[model samples]
Each structure stands twice: as C-alpha cells, then as structure tokens.
Target: MLEEEYQPRRQLPVHLRPPVQPEPVFEFTIRDATLADMPYVREIYNHYVANTVVTFDEDAMTLKEWRTKFSWVSKLNMPFLVAVSPTSTVLGFAYVSPWKQKAAYRRTVEDSIYLGPAATGKGLGKALMKELLARSKAAGIKEVLAVIVDKGAEGSIRLHESFGFVEVGRLGKVGFKFNRWLGTVLLQKHLK
Candidate 1:
C-alpha cells in the first residue's frame, strides 16, 4: 500500500466561524398608528435622539409633546404608521411631515423612519416604508424626501436607494455629534 501524504485540517479563526443565527423573535404587522402607539413610538425615537445626532434634538419628547405631534400629523391627514408584534409591541414607526411651510410645497413631504435597535436588520424598516409610501401615494403626495445622516448610516442610504430615492443634495460637516462633525445626505423620490 502506498503511504498517504500527511495533511492537516485547516482551522478557521474564531471570528471567521459561521455566525449564530438569531431566532425569529416576532412577526411584524404594519398598520396606521393609533394614539396608544405614541408612547412606544416616542421611545424608539428617543433612543436615537439621546445617542445620536439623527434628529439634532438633545432632549426626549414628553408624552404631551408626542401627543401634539400625533395631532399635527393627523390634522394634515398624513400617514403615521407603526410596525407591531403579535403581542402589540411596537417595533418601528414612520411618518411624513411637511417639507416646507409653504403652499407650493404642500404636495411634497419629508419622511422619517425609526426602528428599535433590536428590530433593525430584519426587514421591518422596509415593510413600514412600503406601507408608508403606498399611503402617501393614496394621499396624493407628489414627492418624498429623506434626510439621512451620512457618517455611519450606509444601511439607511442603501435602503432608500433600493426604493428609488436619489441623492439630490448633501451638506458637509453640518452636524456635530459625539465630538465629531457629521454630514447630511438628502434623498428624494417622486411618485407617479
């Protein structure tokens, strides 16, 4: 018998090992937000507000302030949607607001989408946006704009681009957060 050549099994680095698959924790349902959903929605937004320059706000919104915002969006007949779990846990929320306080800009809206840190990277954002944009079209919206932070938001930029948004403008070093300068990328999408 011929002697077999000695070969050793290759060992992979610990970091290069296959990732642990996360369990399916919840099923999300996208629907118009109710007054009851405001608190959870505020919680999600406050996460970003407190930790990031995403909203340029350093303070959290009080319940009353959240109510005022809900009322304002309702007054405009804008869609304020939430993604919820089967047990009624809010995973994310999205809405549209006036891009500018002028009659000429009434048909154009600025969209904001926020997801709980745990709820991201699982397609919840996309689902909420699909419902949001559909509602916008039904509400006669002509354009939708997204103002995204460009520092560490590549996923956000990619998501918007996947939905046909085009970068129309960029403001460099326009925001300061965590002792570092940040930039804003403005993207727009037109609906027919």
Candidate 2:
C-alpha cells in the first residue's frame, strides 16, 4: 500500500482570518485639542460606539451631546489631546476626565481614547496616551484610570500596561451588548 501525505486544516476560514493591516504611512503630530477638532473627534468615537463593543454605549452619540461633554472636559481644565496628520486630519484623541463627580475624585481621572478606523494598528494611540499622561502628570493628577471592555480590547490594555498601568480590578458581565454579556477591566496608573 502506498502511503498518503497528510494535510492540515485551518481552524479559521480564509475569509475569517485577520487582515494584515499596514502601519500608518504618515507621521502624527500630537497636540491639545481645540473646538475645531470636535467634529472629527466625535466621528471617531461614534464609529466605535456604532460598530464595536469597545464602547459600552450601544447608540452613537449626537454631535450636540459630544460638544457638551467636550465643553465639560475643557471647563475642568483636563487634558484633551488630538493626534493630527500633516494635513491636519484628526487621527485620534485621548482625554482625561474626572473619575467621579465627587470632589474627592478630583485628583483621579479616567482616560478615554478613540482612534479613527484607519488610524488604529499604528503607534498613534500609544503616542496620544503618552502625551495625555504627561500632561495629566504636569497638571497635578494623582491617578489615571482606564475602564476598558474585556473583549476586543487587548491592544488597549497592553497600551495602558506599557505606560505603567496595572490591572486593578475586573467586572464580569457588567455590560450587555450585541446580544451578549460583556465584561470590563479596570486599570490604574499612579502619577504621583
């Protein structure tokens, strides 16, 4: 009898395999956000809110609501930064918000970062976070917290961890989205 060659099968189908995403071709300039950047900023965030479980919000926020939120951050004098391309396109944004409304939480801020669909997989997110953290430290912030979705957020967790953030806690099944229960992972970086 003739021996036959063995063949291996792929667990993931070809169409289901992850796509090869190229690194950004353009360099990014990180800077403090301005009122003019709100539209682009909102656009990036709405993309995540609409398409992914990355954000717990199931519905996309209106521009008016986003502007209000931005105004609030500005009023608090927190750092709201945007990564712009050479052409002035907003590639991503990172901001620090009060962790809670109480005065006791004033020194602690929660970080929220959103990258344009095309801007991800590049170093923009990390660069933005570094700038935001530096600014927060300079502004006398004591701690920065990141509450990230457990699923589809490994990159975010890794980015935070790379910047000295450690996982402080995890909340299982705390969110329901896309017909499934999702968890949250809380990470903290002490700046003081």
Candidate 3:
C-alpha cells in the first residue's frame, strides 16, 4: 500500500465500549464449620484443584472424604472454621491440621484456607486467617507452617508474610500438576 493510501487505526467510541463490572462487596461471619459445611468446602477446594495450581490435588474431594477429614481434625482438637453469609451460606473455609503426626510435633500445625470463586479477593482470606491463627494459638499450637505453590500463589505468600510468617525454605519442582513442574514456598510463624 502507498503511504498516501494508509489509514489511521480506528478507536471505539466511549459509548461503544463494554462496561466494567466491579467485584461484589460481601459481608460474612467466620465460625466453626459443621457437617453441612463440608459439601460447600469440597466445592470450593475442588474449584482450585480443577482450575489452578494453588493446590497440587489432581482429584476432587468427595463428601465422604471431606467428612473423614473433618472428623480427624476434630479429633485432634483443632479448629475447622467457615465463613458464611447472612443466610448461612458457606463462602469460604480455613483449618489447621497437625504439621506432623509424630508426638514431638504436637505443637506445630499447618494451615489450609480456601474461598468460593465468587467470594475471593474481598479480604475474606485475611479475616479467616486471623481467626484461624487465634484459634490455633488458643489450642496450644506454637508453630504454623504454610506450603504454597510458587507459580500462582503470590497472593497467598504476601498474605502470610503480612501476618509475620517468614520463609523457612523452598523445594524446587516438588509438585507436578497440569503437565508442568511446580515448586513450593515454605513459610513459618510462631505464636507468642
């Protein structure tokens, strides 16, 4: 094409542009999880399993499996909590499990938190973490460990760091998911 025949790029007028939708601002309360909450919890967790690398789980958890896990954690005297909306709708969940089964590791625990797809990025994660840490401390737990996938969990790392969790170590290519190698960042915090 000749320079004289060149045309300038056309820009869509403001009226023709798509509207930007804002994320919803949700209100919820965090409380101890019940048997009924396990199904919702499973859905939230399975969302991550099927869609993201935040968790290395390749298979979705069933209600029976989640129930067993709930029972086990309850038996250990650990807190399993959920965030719920005004109508008792489960929006997210957080819990602590024994860091290691050995007797010597009784005072240490690992935290796991997950939010429903519609309930993420609205500060509910922090709220759940705050309550989880408090309950962990009250349960005589001294150490909290977080094992976060390195590639897609930067938000989780920052969240843990903001709560005074320090990076203890990292293992490279320790997890394989989505047909690719993934690493982990290990962070630890001690309850005072």
Candidate 2 versus truth, CA RMSD in Å, comes to 7.1
Higher lDDT: candidate 1 or 3? 3
Clashing pairs in 3: none
For candidate 3, the TM-score is: 0.88
Cα deviation at 23, candidate 1, in Å, is: 3.4
* Residue-by-residue lDDT tens digits, candidate 1, 1-192: 345865677989989999889986768899889889989988999999888777767788887888898899999999999998898899999999999999999999999999999999899988988889999999999999999988777888898999999999999998887778889999999988
Q: What is the lDDT of residue 176 in candidate 3?
A: 97
Q: Candidate 1, 103: how far from true, in Å?
A: 0.8
lDDT of 2 by residue, 22-49 (tens): 9547698999898889999889998998
Worst 10 residues of 2 by lDDT: 1-10
RMSD to truth, every model: 6.4, 7.1, 3.8
Per-residue error at 63 for model 3, in Å? 0.8
lDDT of 3: 0.95
- Per-residue lDDT tens digits for candidate 3, residues 1-192, read 999999998989989989878965689999999888899999999999999999999999999999999999999999999999999999999999999989999999999999898888899999999999999999999999999999999999999999999999999999999999999999999999
C-alpha RMSD between model 1 and the true structure? 6.4
Residue 24, model 3: lDDT of: 55
What's model 2's TM-score? 0.86
Off by over 4 Å in 1: 1-22
